[model samples]
Target: MAASSWPVKIYNSSSITTDSLKVPLHAFIRAYDAPTPSIVVRADTQVFLDSLAFQDDGKVLGFDLDHDGYDRLRNTEVRYLIDVYMPTRSLASLRAMGSGDVVVTPSALQNTSVVLTTAGSGTVFVSAPSIELANLNISVSGSGGFQWDVPATKVTSGVDLSVSGSGTLALSTTTLDAGSLKMAVAGSGKAYVGASSLVNVSSSVATSVAGSGQVNLYAAGTCRDHKVSISGSGDAFVSAMNCRDTSAVIAGSGSAYIQSTTTLATSVAGSGRIYVAGTVPGGLPGSYTPMASPPVTTYNAVPVPAYEPHKTKFGSHVSTGTSWTRDNATLIGVLVAVLIVLLVAFGVYRCRKSGRACFRSKTERPVGYARKTSTENQAPSMA
Candidate 1:
């Protein structure tokens, strides 16, 4: 049964392995009750779209509703909600397009690829935490921006980023292990990437067109085989302590801070400066203070013991450990005291109810004989 008022359109790719399933951008996507354009892609038992406003070509699932239809629904009380569900661990891909603010949530895109492109004034936010992404590509053509939080692991492929206009790209990743990384910026665009663990860079550059472009790459752990460039007042910052075979080029009034432990090379022209990690020759440029190295990560390897219930002498299950005994000792003593008091009270009640003496006083008479009075004692002498 479908979960909404409308019927769901099902798409299955269980038998296909040649390429990942694709969801092309179409309608003004929404997440049920939200007012912005958004969607959620996560693992499910079945593959279906919680909407009736889409097209399925057995290869591509795309939204077909136009902006006019979206606007009409937005003005009225009707809601335009869409959610995409995929089979568990299945290969999938999504492309985010068009001219509005968009948000992709949960980042449960395991074994998935994503492409983001926008040319409007609104920003696109892709939240991917602790996922294994195969590939990610992002581009911005106007003043719109992109913010992606991808703490990716086991990524066997590369990441590509481009910004051709004045927009910004805030891309972050935690690379347990990954392949190459490439980025480019033009026309006053800015790109910022913070990568942890091992980071590999083929090329990263900032080229100025109408204004200066800037690319700042902050990497922790080992950075290997990096090629960075800056042209026409553009700037670059690469902060990695253990860099191997890194090359930097500055063409105009740009500056860079690159630290390499194995092989470091730089070429500068037109009043640009390059800062190395440590001491340099007398004719070389100034040195920079590198960021502190990331703390070493360690994991506990010991297996935890399973829990077992403790059996008491009466064959009743009780909690184990000294703390449990300590906590219940006073309560058990109180309960025993209460039981003794209740037994004494019950015996007294039974003696009174049956017209018998439960306890004797010193002045009381015996059970079968009366006590002698003072007159009986005097009469016994007379007799």
Candidate 2:
């Protein structure tokens, strides 16, 4: 059969599926969103190739080459470049399985799900300047790269992005207002969620970096929770503006740096380092001990207050009371006393619960003794 004789197939359906495609060298394929679902295959010149075939079974349309003759053209030279076009509707699910570079542009896809996978070294680019979709999934196993540039307004549900076998994945967006956003890297691959990639999420985000892979996430907005695990020699860097809860587990020599509005629940089993910052309202775990540091204040240079003169009703000049200074000495004293009492109580509670002394130095006075002496002194004053 001649390659030029390959028929163009069109379907009046809501979805499209294609078998595994193995495009010969110098051939290109492009798929985009359209008003209807259609497929077109065009070649520069006629060439005899009995492996090509196209089928449309009412609901699903597929195009592929026969395995027997496809293998025979593995080393054959191609003088013509064949172009394949598969345009689908926004309500359709376009599932493409191949090892070729796929480019998806803005407003080109509003499908329920857009799945693209490649087992070879073929890059994938999905850019949505405007348009929202339910799901977007892309995976690459070879040394190829995947880049997704979309805004939060363009993704209504979630995104699952993954790269393996030394492939790289990059997701860049202004905000991601989805239920969840997941990115994973394995087998020496690298994944990056840029500074403003996910500014806001409704549910949670989970990331995994294993097998010498590296994952970097920065400037994430408010979310319900976040979980990240790093194994092997992989490293993960996460920084968020705000979140309800966060956790990280490092089991290998990898390191993780996380900064969020709340403290993180972390576990470090190997030589890895976990750096966490922000208010820890929930406090650290029982097995975790934090080093205390004194608070530092910064003073700015400013002029002292000056009061302007004002005339009273009696025709006498008087200075206007424009500013007043508050006396917070008593408030400070009370706050300090309360803080000390709370600390002593917490120490005693821990000692009693664990059945062990919670003091670090033997020369220091016990919390109970200090509380007793303070109580006795205050009791005398009260009397």
Q: Which of the numbered candidates is closest to the native, going by highest lDDT? A: 2
The pairs that clash in candidate 1 are none
Candidate 1: tens digits of C-alpha lDDT, residues 191-212: 6666665454433322122226
lDDT of each: 0.45, 0.50
Residue-level lDDT tens digits of model 2 in 176-291: 66667787876676776653555577888887876677766655566788887876667665544356777887655565555445556887554555655454546666222232
TM-score of each candidate structure, all chains considered together: 0.52, 0.60
Worst 10 residues of 1 by lDDT: 374-383
Q: lDDT for model 2, please.
A: 0.50
Best TM-score among the predictions, by candidate number: 2
lDDT of 1: 0.45
